[model samples]
Target: MYRWPFISVVLIIAILLVLAFVLNLSIGEVWLNPFQLFFSENLQSAILISEFRLPRAIAAVLVGSALSLSGLMMQTLFRNPIAGPYVLGISSGSVLGVSLVILGGSIFSAEFLSSNSAIIIAALVGGLAMMFILLMVLKIIKDIMTLLIVGMMFGAFATSVSSILQYFSPGFQVKAFVLWTFGSLSKVDYPQIYWMISFIVLALFFVVLSLKGLNLLTLGTSQLEQFGIKTKRLHFIILLATALLTSSVTAFCGPIGFIGVIVPHISKKILKTSNHWRLMPVSMMIGAFIMLVSEMLTHLPGSGMVLPINSVTAFIGIPFILWILFKPLKNEI
Candidate 1:
């Protein structure tokens, strides 16, 4: 299913993802070294490492994997290089659902449930609800461009809904919502990171199984159906996986951008092929690398204050997006 040469690239990206995890762990405010684990005297250090940095680092890794894989699925399913997790208003829906819990005007205060996991679960449901709408539209309208437009308009509609909620929300709630928009990986704590990783891993396992189908779909729909592929069923499965993966990440980490939309394109360019068997892991590595680097920048000594994760990502992502606009690929489809 994969060229031997492409497999090498996938293996290299795996190594780099591992290194990115290490870098993410080492450079946080409470800086740590994993080798100190055996020294009982360094128990405090271990606590700081395990309780704080590791969870946040793990959040970055899982969120990165979620976004990257989501992007890969979108690009393949939509048959459009520019498609991303946010395109379908899914994240906007998640944010709006969580905003009700966060923005305590007493109406939705009880909804908070005082659990990060609950908040995440709420957001996931909201995102999936929106995704289901888009999938239904896909069934009704077979035009890819039309589906994209629908997703965008749906996002605008979601934003309007969020704005109305914000109007009645307390100032503190609005501030919290604003912070979520900025997006920080630092919100993850020791205990909950495990859950984030668990869901992300489960979602991705399903996506990976669809790699062969993804490759066939990339070759074009008719070609896949010619080989007895059930295009509609495959599309639903992949889109559902994308919705699950993206919803989980955006629910916890807020709506991250750039890397998801751009990373797959970069992977395709580097691998010189449209093979998802190679592309999936490559996109994950690049996404993880981007997040880890954003995490590292938070440790810049003289910056005085840490920058927002989404801010750094958007800054890095936009230029590449412009480059993509400037240099169209010869045979992207």
Candidate 2:
């Protein structure tokens, strides 16, 4: 049997990514030719491509790659196959923060929560706060399963608080919050997309720098210490990078889930290696492709009906998670 080279596999994924991107740009309520989207004279077509679909498609790429990278880091950090931002409540923390901004009007300043910047800050603070709490818990509890339960509890608490806030919030505010919870890529426009790109790129840079350290981490902290690597600093960098990527996507894309958990596993299975050098880029491309496909599906093409992005992801994620749960755990990492 013959196998394709790594470079060949990457090139194939790149071509698929390009195709997915063009299809995402073209498929919607009213399909438009990808070529005409660029040079067409129609004002409506220009607006749809430039102002709406383009941003959403780009956002899909960013959200997918960011969440997948974050998930990979988390799985590496914890050495758990199922650990992800959504499963661990980091997204819920972000949701709590955004909820405060959108629904906690009586507690927060009405003027402040109106800006996109404010929402981003609120999400970062909330996500980091949750992460800090989890780390502290990890000190007392070495068992990953217990920590996972704790994370779920934290998510539940955050959701409960958000629910209470919604109870008292104005009808319009409640509606807005509910809509955001549905998780739509369409909510992200040009300005928000720019912020997402900047944050994800920053996180990607840090991940690239720390790839070697992360690989060593898989052997254990003591192994890193054997080589004179600063374990604390490396761990901090990975945690911070994951937080930034996870929070930025949640802040803009409304807590899109499962991309983080599923993408890493898929990448590892395809590449048949634990090496981050190959794992990272492949996971990112696969993630972006999955997200673009999900977005296209959510649009329902000719039916003119739209599905929530989260729903589409959940359909894919739930079964995979069940499979993971039932599979025997191995020392793969």
Candidate 3:
């Protein structure tokens, strides 16, 4: 096995993360100097930092780390490089949930379900429903590839249902659904961020416990079984953990993409290691850095206009994905 410069890589990533964090905090609609954030006497700047930018920045870090780790687990479990956190249809499930609330509420005149909190709840329920279905399927089918296919089918089914809802929805309702699909970190307030972070942290605990199993799984099922690992049970635990992490982020952030799909590969490329212990934390940090960069780009700095976070992520993700597809040693990455 090749040796990786783990310490050096970690230090570099930490520096990047710190820089991204400062830039994310400082450059917004109303730019504030980095020093002003801590010591400025202006009350409005303090409010903006605490009330608005802080929550969004925290959300970016939490959501990015959660999705990236989830993606790494899915890739390990399925032994598929293209497999992502949303590959299990949890995000589509979230979309379906949001669609029902946003579109359905419009049609039914149900004002209660139209609120931000209600929509987040609906998204969580929808995602968990699909996760439950996947768990049931996992019990019936032991083959990993087949389960991956089934998950895709479920995602397609959820998407179709959401499209039907959109078709029946009025213009304003359709617009609302469209905007939600675009993804936003700003919508998450401090209270929502607290719960989101809590769930992600809990899910991460399960992931940490399974780190040894994840390393074995990377060597293939036979190797895993040779170690007396119950692949099915391990798979269940990882899937559940992935579901919890991915679904919570999707519920609150509205299915932000590319972090899960791209960040793990980036970590592998930089760290030059397949070991989960190194890969997991590096991926989390890289994910956070990328998300902070994405958030900064969305602000457009001097333009006073913000781009959709989803668009920014896609722009960054798509190129890396293409590189992976076209690389001579694609499978190795």
Task: Tell me, by lDDT, which candidate is best.
Answer: 3
Write candidate 3's Cα lDDT for 1-333 as tens digits: 565579988999999998899889998988889866789799998898899999999999998899999999998888778889999899988999999999989888885778898889999999999899999998988577888899899999989998998898899889888998999999889889989988988898889888989999877663457698887888888988999999999999899998899998888788777799999999999999999999999987578788999999999999988888889245564
What's model 1's lDDT at 23?
A: 66
Q: How much does each candidate deviate from the true structure in C-alpha RMSD?
A: 3.2, 3.1, 1.6
Stretches of candidate 1 above 4 Å error? Answer: 1-4, 33-40, 104-118, 221-224, 302-304, 330-333
Off by over 4 Å in 2: 1-3, 106-121, 128-153, 170-172, 220-223, 327-333
Ranking by lDDT: 3, 2, 1
Q: Give Cα distance to truth, residue 288, candidate 3, Å.
A: 0.4
Question: Model 1: which ten-residue window has the lowest total lDDT?
Answer: 105-114
Instruction: List per-prediction Cα lDDT, in the order shown.
Output: 0.75, 0.83, 0.89
Weakest lDDT window of 10 consecutive positions for candidate 3: 324-333
Candidate 2, residues 1-333, lDDT tens digits: the string is: 354678988999999999999999999888999877788899998898888899999999999988998899888877778888576788899889878988885446475574666766787778878888876776676454576788899999999999999888888788777777778898678888888889888888889878988888677443476787876566667766887788788888788888899999988877777789999999999999999999998987569899999999999989998887776335453
Model 1: residue 154 alpha-carbon error in angstroms: 1.9
Question: What tens digits encode model 1's per-residue C-alpha lDDT throughout 1-333?
Answer: 344587677778778777777767667555556455435377787776677777787788777767978988887877776788787778887876776556643346674443566666667777878888978987986555577788788888878877887888777768777887787787887556666677677777778767778888776653466787776667767777888788878877888888788888878877877768777878888788778877777666644477888887888889988888777786443
In Å, residue 332's CA in model 1 sits off its true spot by 3.9
